[model samples]
Target: MACRVLEYLILPLVGAKTLIVGAKSVNYMKKNASTALRVRWSGSIRGGYSSNHGSRFYFTFDRAPCTGPAGIEAVDWTGASRNYHQHIEFEGLCNNIPAGHMQIGFNVGTLPGISWQPYLGWTTSGKPKITAEEVDLGENKGMCPHHTVFNVKQHTLATADTDSGIYGASAFRYTKLAPDTSLRVRWFGALGAKSQSPAPGCLRFYFTFNGEECKSPTPIDGAIAWLTDPIIQTRTTHSSQGDYAVALNVGQCLFGNLNQMDPDPHVNDVSRIIVEEVRLGKSQFAEQAVLLTCSFESSSICGFTQSTNDDFNWTRRSGGTSSSYTGPSSAYSGSYYMYIETSSPRVLGDTAVLYTPNLNLAGGCGRLVFRYHAYGSSLGYLRVKLYNGQHMTQQLWAYSGYSKNTWQETNVYFKQGGNFQIAFEGVRGRGVTGDIAIDAVAVFNVSSSYCNSPNRDLPKAAQQVFNLRHWNWYNLNFTGLGEIKSMIYPKISSTSGLRVSMTATVMTSQRLGPCTQWQFRFGGHVCPVPTHSVEGSRYTYSYQTTTQHLFPITVSGICTGLPAENLVLSIHTSSCGGSPAVDAVTGWQTSFFVSAEEVVLP
Candidate 1:
């Protein structure tokens, strides 16, 4: 809720230079004289929960402003098995200047400069090339509109243009993001037909941040294009349309322009472009107090509503339900959900419900979590009422008959003191199979035994060794330096006894008793904190006013000296200066993996 993590050094780089980082052994090198590059980083990082320990970072560079003298021969580290995030490569070369100016900067000596963003490419001699930096896709588009195809060796950006209103854009630019963070944008194409009338041949997304842009209430001229609800006309081939990631506190730069609009070029394409860092429960203090979540997977209906006196209105569907043996041939997670097909003008009890948008459980307690799908044999029934505006004040879940065919996961747990709204309700039964579906409908406020104890905050399958499920939230800028490296190999070959941990779950508007600082390093050791805590409870939420701290901060040891192949885990943080700077948001429902302890022999 408050922020700071700043430090900048343009590094002008001139004469006298020589460097080597991450050792490669050249007799430990040091021979180019002139004096200007030293660089050294050993291990032992440890320091989570904040108190500002040690703090020191100073490395400057900038010798070839544009066309001469640029030293820096080696600085390796790449992908390392890849998953959460990794890579730090740089070989160095300059002086040619056929016209390439140079501008590498992949960043992360101290994280937040937009949390390490780089994906620009160009080198026909104009310089400014950098390619692998992912979790989705960031910058990369110097040109691609002759009808489309920017494939610089498969980075992808297709098109056929097909006329209608004319469109073929593919621009992208993401930089310096911090505040609340969560921009994602993903892609995979389709839309040649299956559904495409006044719409479908779509992939319209346009955004600009900081200077402000993205009006989208459904804009096309004032622009605000697609923050969600874009399926490109429901499949025609390649899948994964992604495009429902937009949660920003606006810390600065972010520009995404992806337009593929084609009316019918033939098959339509979109290929790749990801920007992940998504988060949605499983940890991080167990999805703290979220009021509503909805995974209807856009194209509308994520707000859930129906009732002009319901008789036949609850069908956002996708996949099945034209008759057959009842609904759902897909979607329990994404692509769409929300149903009540019932076949032929519908009959029997005939109801359709669906409402939710009035939650205010500041302290009335809550927890909803949903997922449903009833299979065949003429089924019907899926209630879950609780209105409080005028009628129906509690039913909290009810299901009948066929409860399996796959999707089924419910957890109600409630208590209401004030505002409320949640309806659902679908009853139909007896006939063309009845249908009935629902999808990830989340709503949490905690406690009911931590909303049915879903691993109370993991790490104890006997010390556990691989958990991977990260959701990274952000906000911590002491002016400029930020850090968040991750790369865990842990298949165990030798870290001897193994032990490494880090816990976090923070939010604040004020209550700075130990602000929010961390400093953990894995493979190379220095992870010793033994144990730490502050979870004495302090939640309070209606939709964020801040005040949710649960810094379970625990760092164990016995790294046995460390090193098992690039293992890295670095997490650095700073700023306990007083108020403002403790909003780790704890990566949405938590998990930053790397733990070990299976050595049991009798």
Candidate 2:
């Protein structure tokens, strides 16, 4: 037997009508007698059952707007009640043996206007139960707003047990506001549930607005014996063209109780699913555009500079220019290709160079890509070098000898900062048959290192050495003792060690004997043995009698976490028999090279 109850509240004096449509019923009333009759409607459903049973309720009303009850506005489900024409609410209870279930829900037809909000509430007893709160009915049309229902129920078993029992209840309502000039949506709702069982239990809540699903439902899973935190979610979506949708989901899981003696171990499990808040708004996506793009197909070198040496230069040549050239007739992609070639009787040392305009690489790593063609019996060598300044250069790529007659693409990576140029040099070989060509050069900054890699040739133990930190090549005549402090070497913050190498040549103008001694000290410490004695002599009649003695020493020490500072080298000289002078000749006559390198220990 089933127990069902129906209740109605009507105000006939206000031109109101009450009707029951299917399992759901609605009561409608006009705001006033003078103005166009605006009907106010509310829907509800109640039922009690045992075993497997479920039911759905629906309510509908004409497209009419009426102000809600003055005193009841603030207490309405949506908090701030407005003029609405339709609302729906439902509740249900289940009583049976271990295997029993019940479900109830309310649905309504579509209504006019875009302003609408839905509220939800749910409660349950015991654990180890699975439940889904809401589902999408259909699309939203102007007629009656699509109907979305909220429902809650408990699972049951086949056998009856006095200790096994389950019950659930839920309610919800919705209202629409005045339509906005732009596309937008605002929705709010509250739903809750609970279960207790040894097996896992789950619950889910769904919401939809403006014909689109907002976000997926939030799910809660239950443990063997655990309680979940209250779940409250809110969402808002806005669009300039009313082309958006909003939705929410809530779920919970309740694990079965192992200690329970009852056949239905889940009878002792407990859980809850609640949606305390839900909101939806509107939004639009912004537009975007590319900043720049370059392709050398139009004969535009893209700001690359070309230079030649000894009348040998890279010139743009079309296909079929010569018989020995069997590569692409045009550029790698465009209709023109830049190539360097020697005359029939080529000069062995003739050279040609191509340079790219200064490029900014401070952003990070950068890539230089180009296609080259090198064929024929006597192929000249081609090399790519990076030039930071007039004297600082790094070779990036090099190639020589014959290759496939087809174009081969090459990519070069560099990490140096600031403006720098890339140059390609082609050297003439023994025969005039050598011909080289390049095309499609591109240089661009990259977020990641394209060329930075460990030096495989350097032993692992030596890879920690930093670049040449400080160095000084001195060429000055020293007649007596002299202290030489090399230039100040700035140690980077990460420097852990320093390596120093010094070489000095002593040239005596007159006769030299073993009595002359020279001492070299680094950082206040003697580099080698304290004094090195010179014992030989060279007599030159035309020039000053010159006898040279070479002193070379290499040493390293820990920096001890010191700040960047200068390193000084002191040279002491003494003559026991005759004066020995430190020669300072511009060329190779006399020279002192002192260099220091910073090292980071592993």
Best by lDDT: 1
Question: What number of clashing residue pairs does each candidate have, in the order they appear?
Answer: 33, 67
Each candidate: what lDDT? Answer: 0.37, 0.34
Candidate 1 lDDT tens digits, 1-602: 00101111112222211222211121112222221122221111111112111111112223222222322221111111111111111222222233212233322222121122211111110111121110112122322111011111111245444342223443344332322222323222211211222321223222233323333211111111111111110000111222232211111112232233323323232322323222111222222345767666676665676887888888887787788867779886546788888887788788888898778876566767677888888787889999899598879889987646777767666777678898988988877787888886777564344434466332111112211222222222222124655554432212122333333322322333323344455543443322211011111111212323222122222233232222555555444334344444332122222233212110
lDDT of 2 by residue, 315-419 (tens): 677663464544445655546777777656558868887777776676656656577888777777889988885544689899998567788877555676787
Single out the weakest 10-residue window by summed lDDT for candidate 1. Answer: 228-237
- Could you say which candidate leads in TM-score? 2
